[model samples]
Target: MKRLVLLLTFLCPMGFIALNAQSSSIFIGATGGANLSKFKFTEDLKELYPASNSLLGLNGGVTIGFEVQNFTLHTGLQYIQKGSEYQTDNFEDEQGTGFYSATEKLHYLSIPLLIGYRKYL
Candidate 1:
């Protein structure tokens, strides 16, 4: 589950907007270092236990938007999860064992701004 979320998060942003055959274009994007991280029991427990500020790893997913003249809508699905640390009293205890991971995934309609310079090759 966690890995799935990570995969989605990483992929969804590849081509959120796309043009038509007339346009024919590809998108370019990138991010900082430190792509994904290992699972942390403290963080996982906190995200499930309490509701507070938390830190987490990043996942990716890609969406392909079609071009309809001057503008277009990019619609697709996404699955993402984050590393967290709550350290509160609201979750099962794990002593040197291992905590199950958490993930978020869903199919969605994503609309992005597509100029007249994008299309399929």
Candidate 2:
């Protein structure tokens, strides 16, 4: 995590500098989306739950883009929420219900850098 942060700290400034030096047409944007996530247990853990269900998650981020002629450079930073829930029939408390549920959540920071060329036919 620390390494990821450090790398981004260094790369972001350099990316901005490179974009400014090369392109006069710069564009900034923001993006957001939703995801459905599920967990597939391994063979050893399959006995715990018959199946896992999908959970709704969200992601959003900012984008920086530089364009010159037919070529473009793009980069962005995003935050993602991901996880899933599972119901198990084997686990039981003193009540003897033999049913339980669990949730797992994960948060992530994502950075994407891309370069592309566009052509008109």
- CA lDDT of every candidate: 0.46, 0.88
Question: lDDT, candidate 2, residue 39?
Answer: 88
Please provide, for model 1 over 17-69, each residue's C-alpha lDDT reduced to its tens digit, 9 standing for 90 to 100: 33223564334443222233333457655456454334554544556655444
| Number of the predicted model whose lDDT against the real structure is largest | 2
- Kindly provide the TM-score of model 2 when superposed on the true structure, using C-alpha atoms: 0.73
lDDT of 2 by residue, 19-104 (tens): 66774697999999999999888988989888799999999999998887677888999999999999988987799999988899
Report the C-alpha displacement of residue 43, candidate 2, in angstroms.
1.2
Q: What TM-score against the true fold does each predicted structure earn?
A: 0.31, 0.73
| Model 2, C-alpha of 88: deviation from truth (Å) | 0.5
| TM-score, model 1 to reference | 0.31
For each predicted model, how many residue pairs clash, with residues at least 3 apart or on different chains?
21, 0
Q: After superposing candidate 2 on the true structure, give the runs of residues whose Cα lies further than 4 Å from its correct spot.
A: 1-23, 94-96
